[model samples]
Target: MSSTQEFIDEAAKIYKVLSNSTRLKILYYLRHQDSETDVKTMVNDLGLVQPIISKQLGILYRYQLVCRHKEGTRVYYVLDDPHVIEMIDDMLKHVKHEIKGEPHPRTLYDNKK
Candidate 1:
């Protein structure tokens, strides 16, 4: 595979979106839920203001990282892709190993060299 500036810039957008702790929390919450939830539910569950939840959700929605639907007057959200959970899990694992001073397995790029 080749790395291009365009690909790197596009990939950076995803990391930027996930960089916000509140967005990560929202993703984690939705990942564990059996059903989609509205902004009110998220606000209550996260203890955040509705506007804040809505704003973060807007970013997720724009990136298609979350599925959103409107029923009646309320909009509900859920995880759009299961891979996001796996990505988050893998990143957390890497961070945990770094924190513990444990040697990490060779990454894909490392193996490519």
Candidate 2:
């Protein structure tokens, strides 16, 4: 396969992982926060068990979609980059404001002239 094909295939794998709402929600929640939080927080907020979150995070880490840090016996996961957070945040903002309700105007006008 060509370089482009390889890239697309890799992207598809990440998308396949993200296609599940559980994983996507995990990513979304992790996207904003810089510091690593424990799985208990995920369970408390996302209602996912520690094992399940660990499994999904493993998949994300395998695909280079997330990074995990080991702190003694506990492992913490965070988005691989700030860009990932920015992209997800922008996407959520777009969907929430543009598609979920009446479409908000795309541009603002000034009457200073």
Candidate 3:
């Protein structure tokens, strides 16, 4: 495949990963954390079952969107890229404006004032 197609494919994969609400919740939860978080903590805090959390975490790890480390018998996860967080934050702001029926401020894609 050409380099342009490869880049589009990778970008599509990332969007697919982010398309799930469960995964987005996981990312948002991790964003507020002060340190690496374990599965059990996520289960209790997010009100999700252990199996579901584990499954979603596996996908996040596979995408390299989150990093993990072993602590004793537990595995802890933290965000691997601040750029992903920024992208999510920007999208969220846009969403909020849409929901409020307010005009979104100029963004890179906007050429008109």
Best of the candidates, lDDT: 3
lDDT score at residue 91, model 1, on the 0-100 scale: 97
Task: Name the better of 1 and 2 by lDDT.
Answer: 1
Runs with alpha carbons beyond 4 Å of true place in candidate 3: 107-113
lDDT of 3 by residue, 1-113 (tens): 89999999999999999999999999999999999999999999999999999999999999999999998999999998878989988899989998999997777778753
Q: Model 1 reaches what TM-score against the true structure?
A: 0.84
Candidate 2 stretches with Cα past 4 Å from truth are 85-113
> What local lDDT score does residue 25 receive in model 3, on the 0 to 100 scale?
97
Q: Summarize candidate 1's per-residue lDDT along 22-72 as a digit string, tens digits.
A: 999999999988999998899988899999999999999998899999999
CA RMSD of each candidate after superposition: 3.1, 5.1, 1.7
TM-score of each: 0.84, 0.71, 0.91
User: Which of candidates 2 and 3 reaches a greater lDDT?
Assistant: 3
- Candidates by lDDT, descending order: 3, 1, 2
lDDT of 2 at 51: 91
Extract clashing residue pairs from model 1: none
